[model samples]
Target: MEINRKIRSKKLSTRVDLTAMVSVSFLLIIFFMLVGELSKPKIMDLTLPNSCDISCGPIGCFKANRFYTILLDDNNKIITYFGLLELPIQSPKELQYGKNGIRKELFYINKKVREYSASIGKPNNGVIVIIKPSKKSNYANLVDILDEMKIANIDSYSIVDYYTPEETKLLAMK
Candidate 1:
């Protein structure tokens, strides 16, 4: 009897295949892309409060401990303040026309709105965010900010008359 030797074909070699490494790399790439997307900044949708202080008295308005005004210029800049004596808090990051054409200054406005709301203890009665747009400003800017305020859950605001509070008080007395 002759002894027979068996040789496996070199092409049939079956060591640890790299197919799993390639699949893992793909899965990792997809996971990283999804995580990066989730980390990106999102446009906040603030909910505004509905106004019930329709029949407000002058003294009642002044009785409130805090006030806030937000002004948007045509150039998409923002100016904000809490009271008559308070200096406007301008955004340190200058807001210009966003490259995308939609005014990103809206995010700044929402941040300030929350700050004012917190300062005033959430204003269960009412908190108005005055939006005074420059004559040259498009109505779109006003609508957009108002929408943002609504999303921020801040309601009870009004499109105020151009009158200064002092002027309005005098008119009320008359």
Candidate 2:
């Protein structure tokens, strides 16, 4: 009699189905990209003054008495004066960088300019700040002054790189 033999076959798969994994990974990547795009930083809009040499028509030229100049020097020193340097309404004075320093002066000067303008029948006209950042001044100093402008609610301001001979001499002193 012949003996009957039973044969067993083994099955094995070397490939894995990665469709779900790939789809999930793509979904995650898209989600993170959207989140990053949505979280972008908001920038402040800076409106510079017109480049009119003689006079500005609709905007009107800023009077010397209504102008305020802040000079940024090395070591974060701030030199501020009201009106033109030649005939300053308030003489140039060194001020520290903070609330009690530049901030206070800005508030006082703004109030004074507004009052003066109102008295002169130009209630809408206000203080105009001119920021002169010297080569020696750091970027942080400029940024700080800009922040102070915002905090002071100054609507009209400009950053001028050119310095007058008198201003250069002023920065050199102390």
Candidate 3:
């Protein structure tokens, strides 16, 4: 006997609602942004002058009493002179590389500069450092001296290429 059979097929919808997923993603992004904003980085602020300023003129314009020159040579030998480069009045003081070495000297010199500025009724502009790296001086010594400057809180410093005869003589004096 042939029996009639009824077949029923149910259609399922493939479309999905993505509103919840989109909202969760936005929340995660905002959470990360807030966390990033809360954690701030600590850094030292160094104010470098404009390189293209023509009015800067020469280093001679800087205060002579506040000028300090550091000469680096081979064997990690550092010679520091305080005074005007134009005058050979002060002798170069030989110093080692350490806290008790150049750092102490710098502190005393800076104190003197401050006192001088106070006497002159001018602001303490700090010392102007002239770093002259000789051919015998290696890159490490130069970097060490620069680090010392930062530790000393030196505000004004410049690397000069030319070496004066007086400086050469001072270096030769052992």
Candidate 4:
């Protein structure tokens, strides 16, 4: 009496098809991947180089015999160039100094550069422009200023630390 001879398939075994589930999971992964890529914020990275180990002191105060120096200060200001304060800086949109007053600021500054070139019996065309961006200054502004400087025929350039104590003493004179 123990064994029921044949249990006529009395139970319905349910099996779930995982194909659709797998497809849905893949789609979700793709969506998140693309969204994460597109939603990323655009950021500007500025890496201040460690290559500028050379000390700029009173020696840098005077333009090198073959080098033209343009100083970039903390305020994104192009201060003191070729032994003069406020070396000509033209504005971005103006053709003449004091005209539209935008482009000429840099043009005027470059004019001073040319004058310095002539005074020193140099070509002034491929001069070296020194960048002294303050630790607190805006990097974008520095880049903009450098772009303008390049437009002004100053092709070669450098970045140096400003105000080495003795250098400050010299700058204080004017």
Candidate 5:
């Protein structure tokens, strides 16, 4: 039996075809990339002025009715007034931080402006908001006001540091 045994020399190849796996991997990468772009958060576009003027020059040309001022105190209180700094209407009212507060007031003002523009046969002169943060106001309040501006769809707004004498008195009071 040993003399009749025969020897075999065949060997198996170790090569593997990875084309299908590679294609699947690439497809998964593309799918994830598309999902990432779709899941991105929406952001508001804010345009800042090129100059930092304490007071707007040539106040006569400035539309008094379209201007607004918002003051933020250290205690997280907001005071909003409309019209020129030389003479604000009555006094700034206290407002909370949300849709029912500043957002409502801004929409009302904007509506009046739109009505006035229609009467004059002119396009809307968007409301200009001047945000003044007192020395003691926190950063969170500033962010919140900015968010409110976005929610209100305000187009023209500025973060100004200068406070008029009247504003100073207002902030100094309890």
Candidate 6:
């Protein structure tokens, strides 16, 4: 009589349970979506001037003495002048970018304009700045100038693309 032995095989399952993983992924996506929705984009508000008759002739809408023009050129060069280039109250001067540069000039001019307006009994009227960006200028230059305007607390300013004949001559000199 010989002893007999029996062998048994263990069974294995091939299916996987992905319920927890799927739930975690969905939660992460939802969290990111909610975070994105909660954050708002920063933007600047631009106010445009109303329509005026062509007869106003460039600086006609505003008094010439209170008008301040800033010309943005390539390489961050800024040429500024008070009143018309033809008859500038404060002849065209090349200024650099930043606090000691354009910002300083702006503060000085703003104060003077305010005093002049007050002397003339037009206390409400303030300095009007005209920003003329040349074709050679970049978008960053425009934005920087706009920031300067805001920093200087300027209430009235406009971005003009066209360059006058005198302005073209002035830029050519640079």
TM-score of each: 0.40, 0.75, 0.67, 0.39, 0.72, 0.74
Residue ranges of candidate 3 with Cα displaced over 4 Å: 1-62, 85-89
CA lDDT of 90 in candidate 5?
33
Ranking by TM-score: 2, 6, 5, 3, 1, 4
Lowest lDDT block of 10, candidate 2: 47-56
| Stretch of 10 with least lDDT, candidate 1 | 85-94
Root-mean-square deviation per candidate? 11.6, 5.1, 5.9, 8.2, 4.6, 6.0
Pull out the clashing pairs in model 3. none
Evaluate model 6: give its TM-score.
0.74
Which candidate would rank higher by TM-score, 3 or 5?
5
lDDT for each residue of candidate 2 in 41-69, tens digit (9 for 90 to 100): 97765755444422536754446787899
- What tens digits encode model 4's per-residue C-alpha lDDT throughout 33-142? 99999999976443332233233586453343323344443444444444323232321121212223313454555566567678768654434455555555577756
**Residue 120 of candidate 1: its Cα lDDT?**
72
**lDDT by residue for model 3 (21-122), tens:** 999999999999998988878555454423331133455443466678899988999998887556633677899999999888887777777787888886
Over 1-174, each residue of candidate 1 has an lDDT whose tens digit, in order, gives: 977989776786568879999999999999999999999997745433344433347544442323445555555554444444223343222233443322334444445655766777873444445555655567887777666665555554555537456433333332
What's the C-alpha lDDT at position 141 in model 1? 74
Overall lDDT per candidate, in order of appearance: 0.52, 0.87, 0.78, 0.50, 0.79, 0.86
Q: How well does candidate 4 score on lDDT at residue 114?
A: 66
- Positional deviation of 94 in candidate 3, in angstroms? 0.7
Comparison by lDDT, 2 against 5, better one: 2
TM-score preference between candidates 5 and 6, better one: 6
